[model samples]
Structures are given as C-alpha cells and as structure tokens.
Target: MPTLRDIMTPGLVTVDPQATLKEVATLMLEQDIGAVLVMDGEHPSGIITDRDIVVRAVAYGHDYGTAVTDYTTGSVFTMEADTDVQQAAREMADRQLRRLPVTEGGRVVGMVSLGDLAVRTGGSADETALQGVSQPSADPQ
Candidate 1:
C-alpha cells in the first residue's frame, strides 16, 4: 500500500481566489485537470472544480469575470502526505469527494484524486471508491 506521497500528483494547480472564473477555467482546461486549489499565498483557502463553474456560476447567470471565490468550495478537505492511501480513499468516499490536497507540515504539497488512487493501487476498494466519486451529483459543486 503506497502512501499518499507516493502516488499523489506532485504539484498543485492553483488559482488566486480573486481570479476571474474565466481565467481559472482556462487554466484547468489547459492543464487537463478537474480542480484547482484556491490559494492565498502559500495557504490553500478553497477549491474550484469544473462542476462549480457550470453549477454555481453558469446556472446563476454569473459572467466569466466573476470572482472564483464567489463559487469555489470554501472549505477544502486535505490529507497529509504521509497518510496511508487506503485511509485517504475512505475519507474521500465518506465525503463524496474526488480530490484532496496533500499537505506536508501544514503546507500544500500536492493533490490526490480518485484516479490517482485507483491507478496506483488497483483493487476492489479503490475501484468502488472511484465509481462513487464519478457518479453524478445533484448538488454539483
């Protein structure tokens, strides 16, 4: 069983909380990622997913220039880099989350997603957790 530090994406894709939704969306698309950390300097303040843009900003008729903070998930869940991958998977399953920031000494170091877990440790449990995360959500964001 790998630690999160072994399998997590080893860098953060971040956006300033004050950035426009358009800017963040472009970055996500260019990076081919599903989520971006909303950073306040080196501190992570929130997260913004593609679902957040479509559900919160688009559905609400907010324009592209809208601040990312207006629709970003304000409270993010994180895991320590040393955490066991299975335990991290359980936390994500319980929260119905697809991504978690990986931290070291309380500083953001990387991110882990359902795909990362599944690919690094292929097993029934990881498969199930990934399926659960991939399921459509009514709340979207």
Candidate 2:
C-alpha cells in the first residue's frame, strides 16, 4: 500500500484561472503533459486537459484568448500526499478523472495522474485478473 507521495509527480504544472487557453495549451505542450491544474491564487479551482482544448475550443470555435477556466472540467479534486495510492486510484476512477492534485497540510504539493497509478499498480492483482480473462483457457478434462 504505497502512499501518493511515493508515486506522485511532484512539482505540479499549473495555470492561473485567468490564463488564456492558448497560454495553457502552450504550457501543456511545453511540459508534454495532458492535464494542467487551474489555480485561483493558492487554491485549486479547476483543471484543463488537452482533450478539452480540442473538444471545447476547437469544436466550439472559442478564441484562443478565452480564459482556460471558461471550459474547465468539473471541479478540482485533491488527495492528500500521505493517503494510500489505491484509494486515490479508486476515487479517480469513480469520479471519471484522469488525475488529481496532491496536497499536504492543505497545500498543493504534487500531482497524481492515471499514468502514475498505472505504473504503481501495473502488474498486480488487477493485471492478473485481466490476464485470466483475456487469455484463452486450456482444454479441461
């Protein structure tokens, strides 16, 4: 049962809520990440993803100058750094989230993405179960 701090990506990449979509997109590209946390000063406000840019901005024809928060998804979700990584993974799946802001003492400390969870729990029970079903069964006597 690893803690989020053990597998989380520290040094989160964030953008101000007032930042333009172009600016956020630029940051994502520069960082080579799919998601960016939107912050309102010291508090997390929302999140924007590369897919959101393509779907909301491109599909809706929102100007690049539009604020990133204008089309952010749902609300910001945070998990304590000391929490069990499996718990965070479960919450993310339940909420249909790909990532979460990692916190300690109510202050943003890092980020835990779906990729991180996959890496952490890659070849354990879940993978074994998946393999049991996906692989062909041998002939039974």
User: Which candidate has the top score in lDDT?
Assistant: 1
The TM-score of predicted model 1 comes to 0.89
**Candidate 1 lDDT over residue span 82-135, tens digit each:** 998888888887778888899999999999887787677876347656766767
Estimate, for each residue in 3-92, the C-alpha lDDT of model 2 and write its tens digit.
889888989898888899999889998999988888888888988889999998988887999988888975677889999876666666
Best by TM-score: 1
The TM-score between candidate 2 and the true structure equals 0.84
Cα deviation of 33 in candidate 1 (Å)?
0.9
Evaluate all candidate structures by whole-model CA lDDT and list the values in order: 0.85, 0.77
* TM-scores for the candidates: 0.89, 0.84
Scored against the true structure, residue 89 in model 2 reaches a CA lDDT of 62
- Identify the runs in model 1 with alpha carbons over 4 angstroms from their true place: 131-141
